[model samples]
Target: MAKDYMPPSDFLRALIDEDVEIEADDTATIKRLLSFFKDPDAANRDWAVFLLGQSEVDTKAVRDALIGALNDEDDSVRAEALVALAQRDGDLARPHVLEALSAEGVYPTVFEAAALCAHPDLIKPLRGWLKATGDKEVDQMVAEAVAACEASAK
Candidate 1:
């Protein structure tokens, strides 16, 4: 049987609770939560990183941390980091996201990263994929991304 696990810090408990509270004002809460990223406990650090991705507040420190997580030893962490970075700065992350998508034996995480980027420049690469491979899923994602970009531009 698996034992029930408890979060170690009051700050973390509050953070997790806040993640589920749609009515909670994200700006103030996310600012407070960002500090936990440097907590002494690895669990706290990881949790902070994960939550930072979900937060609406944008900051240079959060961006740097998420980018650093891209190279983390843990694949799940790396994947989440990529997602956070893409969400935060699709324009800045475009080159890295494209490289990940185009690499041999591309992982689903890489595709997911590209999907989250939703950058206009991605339309070209995604269109090229559609032309070269005729993969319906990739084509559909690219189409959606293009549509989203168009919508945002309007």
Candidate 2:
């Protein structure tokens, strides 16, 4: 079954416009911006979620939207959501970001999110992954994430 996608609303385009006035915390702006997550353009949806993640609107609506974005078909969008969630609520976002590690093709992004959150609980598992993967680049990422977690714990 095909899902019909609506075009981005004028309000949404204006809200996202560089020249148009942007009030990051405006309730209406936030709502309109959040709605772009359903745009037919995957890139649009991904970037919409990315910006929302970066936005200061930490309302439950925004948070829920970002969490939902963790499952977006676009890996980049999902990565942004994971990072944003981790930054917003480290303890809550920890397990999920760690889970992304097990998926294929999203290693670097997930690792970056895990590092940003610096959740101590992730250290052991990251270390385990390090030993198992044996890829020098990934090991570096894992080591950095572990260090970040350890530092945050201190």
The number of the candidate with the highest lDDT is 2
lDDT agreement with native, every candidate: 0.62, 0.72
lDDT of 1 at 142: 55
- Candidate 2 lDDT for residue 44: 69
TM-score result, candidate 1:
0.55
Per-model root-mean-square deviation over C-alphas: 6.1, 5.8
Q: Candidate 1: worst 10 consecutive residues by lDDT? A: 19-28
Stretches of candidate 2 exceeding 4 Å from the true structure: 1-17, 21-24, 128-141
lDDT string for model 2 (24-142, tens) is 56777677777777677776676677667666668788789888887788777788788878778887788887788766545565777889888778777677666456678877887
lDDT of 1 by residue, 15-61 (tens): 67764442235655565666655555656655666667776656776
Please report the candidate that would top TM-score against the real structure: 2
Q: What's each prediction's TM-score?
A: 0.55, 0.75
Candidate 2's error at 60, in angstroms?
0.5
Clash pairs, candidate 1, are none
Clashing pairs in 2: none
